[model samples]
Target: MARIAVIGAGTGAMAAAARLAVAGHRVTVYERSGTYGGSLGRYARDGFVFDTGPSLLHLPAVYRDLFVKTGKEPLERCVTLTQVDPASRHLFADGTAVSLPDASRAGVVAALDQALGEGAGTRWAQFLDRAGTAWDRSRRPLLEEPLRDDREVAARDPYPAPRRRRLLRPARQAATLAQIGAWELADPRLAALLDGYALSYGLDPRRAPAAAALLPYMEQTFGSWYVSGGMRELAGALYERCVLRRVEFVFGAEVVRVAEKDGRAAGVELADGTHADADHVVLGAQPGPELVPSQAWDATGTRSAGRAAAPGRFVVMLSLRGAREAGAVHRTVVHCEDGTGEQEAVFGGRIADVPTVTVSRPDDPSTRPDEAHEAVTLTATVAPHGPVDWTDPALRERFADVLTGRAALAVPGLRERILRAEVRTPAETAADTGAAGGSVPAPALAGAGGAFLRPGNRTALPGLYLAGGWSHPGGGPAHAGMSGALVAGLVVEGDGFRGSR
Candidate 1:
């Protein structure tokens, strides 16, 4: 068995370690945070718990595979999955609203057709049909596996077998813009598609890649799911698996630099001056950590290196008197950012006079005496603007007001819903988390230059392999897990790892 060292104890790193350990490799995960969850870490203050990171859980099967491969049962440990109707809504600036559906979401399509037009439903159905095809073709190639060594994999295991019409079919040809424009409808459906895409690359539908055309169908058709509680459950589940496998987790240990020998990464040295060695090293490569080497940052300097990370929550955790939706664990209340103002500021990297909130409500059992409601998690995306004192007392209050104003734009008396509110900026996030500038899974998504630009899973340095968001397969939670699995696969197979199945 290989003595493997998986870096960063977050979702991506943990997933890689779990997959490797199950595969019979001796894996040890090193996490800088005292807690196991990366950005998925939870912040519980008083009686309320807030997900410090991502809220929604999509692509449930990717996570389920982790348990199944390890000989564990996800259903045994977690709550059953539920498909939410009105998966999300877009309240347009002109007061017209559009709702996105999932899995034969005929209702949403019907409702949308009224606002958009008579043929809107059929147009969406046609778009989804095509989107499904693209999703199948690119799922494994573009999203599941790393792209760096893609040609080699395609030459071998062309997943799904064309007969299955699998999304993970074998193929090539760089995913380009010309491809996405065909389906990116400009009406309400277009906005729905863009919102999902915005969750990843910050690219609006019109600007998003044609390869990403499947964005809507992925949620509406395949289904967007929710865990019993929040997405934190998935992270905790993975962490538990690591312990069960006897993997060591080293948290609160910040990595200072990646050591090199003869031009290869040899090991890592922590900020506390302790050194550790591994047969291999994989970076969770979550957002801020990528900028560590200084060399990791391209010519755009510190700012642009982190610019791609769309700013996330200024969160509000509410323990309401009652909830209308029970066991309905997932709901994202979308707030439109008008074309002229705050929305542009937040999306364009400018200071928003007001913030844009995407409220996430989790399942709560005690919201209404004997009844229950989806516990509420309100998150407003706010910019990290100029010259604010990192330690200033005034920043939180200022941003809270900013978020409150933005919330009023959509939900009236938004402040009344907040049992307690925490205004977290990028700087504050970096302070609590070791990740510099609160960069999560470090823009693992390669910008431009396509696949060649991202570092390969196997780095130039020997005994070092990259997993998580930073690796060739690119970013996103599930994508991170698959990337880590690929790294573990390589180490297990050794030179033959790059060979064939």
Candidate 2:
């Protein structure tokens, strides 16, 4: 059996650890924090609970497969996974609101038509149909398999943009996500909706490739899910599954370096100056300068391609005294009135005067202190750590106020209902999760000179692989799980392993 040392006890690393253990590998996980979940963090105060990390789970099959492959119990048995009906409620800039039914293309189309204009629903449906082609075309190379050095195959835009013909205007295809939104969706609200999907993941629609349409397609097709408790419960289940598979975990043990021998990864050096030998190493977090001899930043440098900066999140956790009313959508997205300006501000190293906000209010009783109280979390995509100082309390409060005010549109009397409130900035996120400058990792996009393609799982150094949101296939909880699977498949099956079937 090969010995494996995994860095970071995050969901992805733990997922790989569990699978590797099941495959007869002696796996040991080292985490800098006392907890198992990395970005899946939780905050509790006065009997109220909130997930500081991602609030929802999309494409839950990623975890379902992990649970099934590692043990006899299905994912449902380990964690209660429920489809969030009316997947989301959107409050547009024009004050038009629509609640889309979960996993129902017809329902979504109908709802959009009912809320928007006559052809809004049809336009959205057509867009989704085209998006399906992008998903099918790129799913294998971009998501299902390890990234290849020759990105020519993956870099080629797969989004089938319809040819536009006009008098004296050459027929052409839409390349960027912004182009697709403007050319196909037509309606300003619909364009904002499309951009919102991309922006929510820290991607800028202005430059993100048309393949970015896959984000909404995946959600609309697979459906969004929520656990009985906060998303932290899902992380707990992964940790438990790894334990059941006999994987050893050492919490609060920070890995300081990846010791190399004979030009291959040999083991890990911990913060305490101790070392553990292993045949292979899997990095779940972006490695620091000490971990490798390379520069502090990867080949892409510390930031994303172009002048655009990495996006961060500004969160507001509210504890309300009132019980959640019946038939309330679990999630609501309040789109920014100035979508373009907001993107420019955030990416240009300034606070958005008006930022798109996502408000999550899960009805599950576990998050509240009985039915009398409710837990609400508000998230806004913002600029990552850099020239902007998220550490300034006044600045953070102002951003939080803007997001809270925007969320007020979704939840009536939201400001009045709040019994208490707490704020989480990218600065805290960076400190808690080992991500540089609290910059949340975005999903890999398809264009702009392969800007979206992340570093490959297999590094130049032998016996070392990467498995996390920052690696190939990119971010999001589901993608993180896929990274783990790919890493395990590569380690166990060798060079021939394309991916799991």
Candidate 3:
């Protein structure tokens, strides 16, 4: 049996450790932090609980499969997974509101038509149909399998955009997501809806490829989910599963560098001036020369190309004195009026005057002290830490106020109802995640000349592999889990391992 050493206790790393252990490999995970879960963090004060990471989950089948493969107990047995009805409520700039049903195209269409206009639903339905086509074309190479060297197949945009004819101009198909919204959806409100999806994932809709349409298709088709306690419970469940598989974990054990023997990854050197030898290594953190001595990897050709300037999230956690209103929508998005200004500010290293905000108020009692009180979370995509000085008290308070003001649209008397407010910026994210500039990585896309694809799982080093949000197939819970699976596949079945059937 090969002794495998994994760097970091993040979701992806832990997932790989469990799988490798189940395969009869002796695996040990070293994490710098005192905990697991990486971005799936939780904060609690005065009996109020808040999920510091992703509030909702999409594509839960990834974790479901992991649980099944690792043990007999399915995911549901470990955590309560409930499909959120009216998946989300959208508050448009013009005071128009619509609540889309979960995983129902017909229901979403009807709701859009009722709120936006008669033709709005039909236009959106058609757009999603095209988006569905993109999902089908790219699902295999981009998601289901390990990233291949000949990326020509995955590099090409799979989105079958409708061709449009302009006066005295040759017929052209939409390239960017913005183009698809304008050319196909044909409504400012509809376009904003589409842009909201892109921004939530840290993608600039203006530059994101048309293939990004698959995001909404994925969410709307698979549906949004919520755990009974919070997303943190999911992490706890996975961590327990790993322990059950006999995977050893070392908390607060920081890996300083990847050790090499005869030019192959042999083990890891810890920050405490210690080393543990292994037959193979899986790196889940951000790759760098200090960690991996290999110099053959090119950051420019992978998702790390934009790591320095990637977008991040600004979160405001509110403890309200009043109980959640009956029939309150679980998730509500307050759309910004000026999409261009918001995009330019977020990407151009500035803060927008008014930014799009997502408000999550899950109908779960565990998050509050009692039914008389409620916990609410507001999140917005913003410039990463380098561009914005999130450390400044003035800046933090001002931005928190801005987000809270926008959230007032979703929560009645929001400012008055708040018993306490806590703010978390990219700076906090950097501290918790150890990611440079606190920049969050977006999921990999299949267009823009392969600019959006992440680095392959297999690296230049013979015995070293990459896993997690920063690696192949890119970020998000589902994609990160897939990264772990791919890393295990490559290690167990050798390089010829294509993917799980």
How do the predictions measure up, each by TM-score? 0.79, 0.97, 0.98
lDDT of 2 by residue, 1-501 (tens): 999999998888888899999999999999988888888889999889999989889989899899999999999998898899989999988789999999999999999999998899999999999999988888888889888767777888888899988789899888989999899999999999999999999988988899899999999999999988888999999999999999999989988888888878899999899999999999888755657545323432333433344788888999998888878889999998889999898888788898999999998888898898899999998888765888898888788888889999988788999999999988888888778778888887665567688877777778888888878878889999999999999999987889877
Q: Compare candidates 1 and 3 on lDDT and give the better one.
A: 3
Query: Which candidate has the top score in TM-score?
Result: 3
Among the numbered candidates, top lDDT falls to 3
Q: What does each candidate score in C-alpha RMSD?
A: 6.8, 1.8, 1.2
In model 1, which regions exceed 4 Å deviation? 75-80, 149-184, 192-196, 199-201, 204-207, 262-264, 286-312, 322-330, 340-344, 366-374, 384-395, 405-414, 441-454, 495-501
Query: Candidate 2: worst 10 consecutive residues by lDDT?
Result: 295-304
Clashing residue pair totals per candidate (backbone < 3 A): 17, 0, 0
Error of 3 at 359 (Å): 0.3
Q: How much lDDT does each candidate structure score?
A: 0.56, 0.87, 0.91
TM-score of candidate 1 relative to the true fold: 0.79
lDDT of 1 by residue, 264-377 (tens): 555678888887775566676443334234333321123334345434445655444344443332454444544336545655665556444565655544222234322356
Q: Give model 2's clash tally.
A: 0
Colliding pairs, model 2: none
